[model samples]
Structures are given as C-alpha cells and as structure tokens.
Target: MSITVQDMRKGPEGYAWSRFGLPEYTDWMDESLSWKQTCYIGDWSFLWQHRFTGPDALQLISDYTVNNFETFEIGQSKHAIHTNKDGKVIHEGVLTKFGEEDYMVHGRGGYWLSFNLDRGNYNAKVSQEDWFMFQVSGPNAIKVLQALTDSEKLLEAKYMHAVPVTIAGHDVYALRQGMSGEVGFELQGPKEFSEEVYQAVLDAGKPHGIRKMGGRIAMINHLEASYPTIATDYIPAIFDADMADYMDFFLSSMPSFAQPAYIAGSFDGQEPSDYYRSPIELGWAKVVTTQRRGYLGADALAAEKARPHRVLRTLVWHADDVADIQNSLLREGEHYDFMEMPRDQRGYMWADRVEINGQLVGTTTSRGYSYFFRKMLSLATVDVDHAEIGTEVTVVWGAPGHRQKSVRAMVQSAPYKQDRSRGDLHQSTAP
Candidate 1:
C-alpha cells in the first residue's frame, strides 16, 4: 500500500529536549504568562536556515515573493511567502537581505528556494547555515535588551529591522522582531555563541522576570500575535502533478516524521493539492499589489484578488462549550478528544471544519489556550461574507469518522492580542 497523510499521526512522541527543549523550564502555564506579565526567552536554534548569493539572487527572490521588493533593503527582514502557480501558498518564512544579491532565510523556505534556484536560469547558489536564534520578548524586553547593548542605537530598532549588537562580549545580530506581537528582539549569531548569548540574556533578564520559554508554550505566541506558520496551519504545496518528481525527492530527503501531513477540516480536499491556500484566503491580500514588480503567479493572483473568497479570521470559542469538553471527560470513557492546555494537538494543524448557518463555509487552524486572554481560541478561514467581527459560526473539533463535537465560536479580529509592542520604551506597557 502507498503511504498516506494519516501517517503523520506518529509525531515526535516524547517529553524532553526532543521537541520541547526544556520540557517545561518552569511549567507551560507560567512560561506562557511570562511574556504577558514580564518577559520570556526562547531558543530557536533548531529552526532551519538557508543563504543565497549571486547577481540573480534578488531577481530570483522577486520572481517568487509576493511582498513588495522595491523597499526591501539590507538589515531589513520580510515575512516571505512562496506559492504555486495556482496562487496557493507553498511555503513561507522570514527572509533577510544581507546585500543586493545576498539573502538569508530562517524557516522551510530554504527547501523550496533551493529547488527553484537549481532549475531556473539563475546564477544564485544556496547554502544552509548553522545559526543560533535566541528571543527576548515581553513588556520588559527592551529594558533587558538595553542593559546588554547600545541603548541609543537599539532604540532606533524598529519592527522587522535587524541590527548588529554585542552581547556577552560576543558580536550578534539582533533582530527587533517578535512572533509574540510584543516588544521583543530575536538575537542570532554563530552557532558557537549560542550558550554565551543565552546565558547573558537570562542573567540580564533576571530583574524583568524573564522565564525560559519552551516548545509547548512557544507557539501560543503565534495565536495571540496572528503569525501563521507552515505545516501546522497549511500543508506544503508539493503534491501537484507538475511537482510529482520534486515531491518524491523532497519526501525522501526529509525526515520520516516530516514526510506525512496531518490534514483536518471539513473541506475534504481530495489531496494536499486541493488544500493549498491563497494569499487572499490567508488574509494576506494587502501585500498582493498587482500594479508593480511581477512575482510568481502575479497575474493569476491578481485575477483571483478581484474575486470573492474565504478570508482568515480569529475565533473565540464559547465559554460554556469549552467547559463541557472537560466536564465530559470526567463522566464518560473518552469525550471531545480532550482539550489540552497551551495547545490541543501536537506538531499538527488542529484544523476543524467551520460553518455558518449549516453551510460549510470555512476551516480552522492553530487551536490552543492563551494564558494571557484566559480563553481557548483558534485562527480560522471563512467566506468573506462571514468574516466580519461578532459573526457566529460552528467549528467541528474532531476528525471525520471519529468522535466529534461542534462548538460555537464567534469571529473576532486577528492578532487577538492587542498591539502594544509599538509602545514607547519608557511607557508602562499593557495589552
């Protein structure tokens, strides 16, 4: 028998440095709260990295990226997206330009970029780099960071800008960015300096109530911040007939665990190809400027942009229904798949089918608990007509042919967590 997507059910099952680096540095709940109450530090060294160089590097990037490239500059970063000809997102990640023709990417975008660079008529060469990433985020993040580097220069560090700094007497690249949607910085440097910078941040952050964040609570930041991630939110676009050979090689090269994808939702797409999403569907339509430098699928995306489609939104589950899941666990054998704290499903998209008035209109991704909001929430995509705030809908919270229960949820604005990261450094920040 051929392999199937359900095989992804066998995720990395263990509690150690295996997936969650610290397991629970100080407990998932407390760590989840550190970013809201004070500050939190996270290690993301294991996130893949890729570098590209050559005269055609920028051209290669421009051809594929949907974001504006005219303003992209050195030391600046972008939430880069890669999509198939159908305009559905293939992969995306954080991309930074080191020069006009030099670029570095942090995430799975490497694999797709490499594949294209090898076949396209470009002089660019791709190389995987070993970089260590350490994040310091929260209301007190600036203070802790200022204590370590040039406060005046760091003060100019705006959102999404990468700056150079020295920490623990080691030169490091400090990127003023955060997935937590808080005032924070993601510090990166050579792999050898990981320990040095990590310890220094922990020590300097002591006065700010810095807690070491782990894998369990790390992704919670995405929900509050509204940052969509690959795999967990959408399947990688590699199953199209045109990409058959590429998919075969890509699957063979990836780890056993990374091969299978866990698909959940009411869409009932025939295969991964049918599940691919577009920029408009993901609520990234704003970045799809058609009257400019052409990128991959620009014409097709422009055509689709003019049409109506489902858009991404946030859902606040009903308090009563959320409580019933737990209440059911106590009375029966197994009820409602058992909602877990921090996040419900592990390493897989907790996608559920979304509906409005008995009509299947959308799907949900990234369901989890937010210690800051004290509510269970999820990021979802629904028809543009039903994408308004305060709109009521139903979310089927279990796989088909298995135990399932429908929960009531209301459409809410995304980045559900208030935007306070842009607040002044000296102000008392509250979100």
Candidate 2:
C-alpha cells in the first residue's frame, strides 16, 4: 500500500514528538533562557548529511540552489535554499565547502540535491553519512568551546567558517554559525566519537554553567531567531505530481520525525500549494541572487522578488486574549484548543490565520512562549502592506473543526531577538 502526506494528516494531534535522544536535564524555562543568559548544547544528530564530490559537485549544487556560489570558498558555509519550479522553498540547509571539489550539505536540502543528481549528467558523486551534529550556543558559548580545545582556531574562525579542532583526541570540525542569535559553534564529527565528544564538551562546559537543551525547548532559539524549519514552518514543495517519485523515496527513507507533513490551525488553504511560500516570503530574499541563473526556480524567484506579496514579521499575541481562551476551559460550552507553552510538543505545522477587520491578511507559524521575554511570539508571513512594525492584527487560533479564539497580535521585526551570531565572540558577552 502506498502512503501520502494526506494519509498522515488523519488527526489534529499530528505526529509524535520529534526525538533528539535528550530530555530536559533542567527546567525547560531555564533551558529556554540558557542560550541567552549562559550557554547550551543541543543535539542535532538527526539532521541529514549528504556529501557531494568531484568536478561537477559545485555545478550540481549551483544548478538547484538559489545561492550565488561563485565565491563559496573552502572552510566557509552558506545557508542554501532549494526551491521547486514554482519558486516555493522545498528545503534549506547549511552547505559547506570542504575542498576544491568536496562539499557537504546538512538538512533536508541534501535530499533534494540527491534527487536531482541523477536527472542531470553531472560528474558529482553523492554519499550519505550519519554524523553527530551538536550546536553549542549562547553568550558564553565561546568560553565553553575554548575550554574544550587547546587550538586557537576558535579565536580565528570567522562567521560561517569551519575550523578543524581536536576535542577528546578526536578530529572534529567546528563551524562558527549561530542559530540562537548568539555566538555559537556547530560541532561535527564521526558518529563513533559522538558519545566521547559530547561528554567531553559537557565536562568542559560545567564551569560555564552549560545547560543540556532537550527536545522540548530545543527550537525556541529558532523561533526567536526567525529560522524557519521544514515541515514545521512550511510544507516542502515535493507533494506536486511531478515529484511523486522523490516524495515516495523521501517518505520511505527518512525517519518518522523527518517524514511527517501533517498540518493544523486556522490558515485553511484549499490545497497544499496554498501553504507554499517563496523565499521572499520567508525573509530569505537577501540570500537569493539574481546573478545566479538557470537554477531550478531562478525565473520564478526573480519574479517573486520583484513583486513579493507577503513579508515575514514577528507577531506578539495579546496576553489577555490568549488568557481568555485558556480561561474558557475553566468556564462552560466549548473551549479553544489549549495553547502549548514554550511550543507545541507535537511537531505540527500549526499555522493560524492573521486578519484585520475580518479580512485575511497573513498566516502565522512557529508560535511559542519565550520565557525570557515573558510573551507569546510567533512568526507571521503577512501581506506587505500590513507587515510594518506595530501593525495590529488578529490571529485565529485553533485547529480545524475545533472552537477557535480571536487573539490580537502586533507586528514586529522578523527576528524577535537581536541577532548576535555573527558578532565578535572574543569580546565576551558572558559575565
């Protein structure tokens, strides 16, 4: 029997929790604040790693991605975006250039690259590997990393640049990339050394008050940093009929957490494409290069960039309005679906409709409670006319076929938190 994404969207609860193998060793609220006040190491081993090699490796990547790779040098990485023919983002991830013709891509974007590899007559050879990817992030991230390695590479590494370092007698590549909107490093190494390296870093970070971020609050940084995630933020563009074969392979090969396409909430689109978003709508227009031509969706992206309808913004939900929904549970009649604190434990693309005077204007995703800010924040893709700062909007929060609530929200910057990931870590923001 063949299965489709619709087959999986059978319930409002969506799929089970995404497994990262680590539960909260401390309070989730404290863990939420760790990346801001102190530091945290979150496990991202489940991220797909695909390596491409040979003369046509860069060509294969450039042909399908929207990034300008003309100056992508060794030891440097770029946040690459892959889109379908319609310019809708299929997947995005970190693409690192290792050698002259050697490159590796992390996240679902690799699958898209692999899917297109055979379609073209490129000389690239593709290989898949399991890697232990850990992200150590926060204001004190540098101090914690400095304790683990004696190499001065940590001090010399530039933003999005990978430096070779030895930790626990194992060669690990540390990439100076921050997803937490703070100083951070993504450590990558062979899976065999996962336990040793992870433990060693934990021990080294003990003095810096490092927190073990579990699956619960693991994505709070992403929400605050405006990093849109696949499946959770937007449905991949693989559901189209042309990509049926690739979709089947993706479903059969990828893990449960990585495979689900279940969606819920108030933004009722008639079809899957209604939920599709262009890079411009996701606040990634800066990464799209008009200089690069012939990529999968170059023409469509160029067109969208010229006339973008929606822009990304942060929506701050009204406390009293949200409280009323929860308060309804204590009252009578029907109650709105409970708003999960921090974030929904069940990983669903919970999109709510944004409106102004009963007129649809935008859609909100990645809604969560930021303990640090003491407010409920969500990422919204609003019509450009209504996306300005302080623009008041109403968010209809509830799953389909359930009692909904009208929650007032105000538009703010896309990244609710100030981005300091690319800032000088040597200056030390740690107290």
Give the number of the best model, judged by TM-score.
2
* Candidate 1 lDDT by residue in tens digits, 1-431: 13344443434452111233457788888899887889998888877799999998888877887878878878999888877877888778889988878899888778777887888999889998999988888888988888898887678877788898999999888888867877888999889878988999989989889999877887788888887776667777767678776676667656664553555544455555555678787778887778764777787788878985877788999888888877888885767776777774456655678887778878888888887788989988788888889999998766666677779999999879887776665563322
Return the clash pairs for model 1, or none: none
TM-score of each: 0.92, 0.96
Clashes of each: 0, 0
**CA lDDT scores, all candidates in order:** 0.78, 0.86
Among residues 3 or more apart in sequence or in different chains, the pairs in candidate 2 whose N, CA or C atoms overlap within 3 Å are none
User: How far off is residue 146 in model 2, in Å?
Assistant: 0.9
**lDDT for model 2:** 0.86
lDDT of 1 at 386: 89
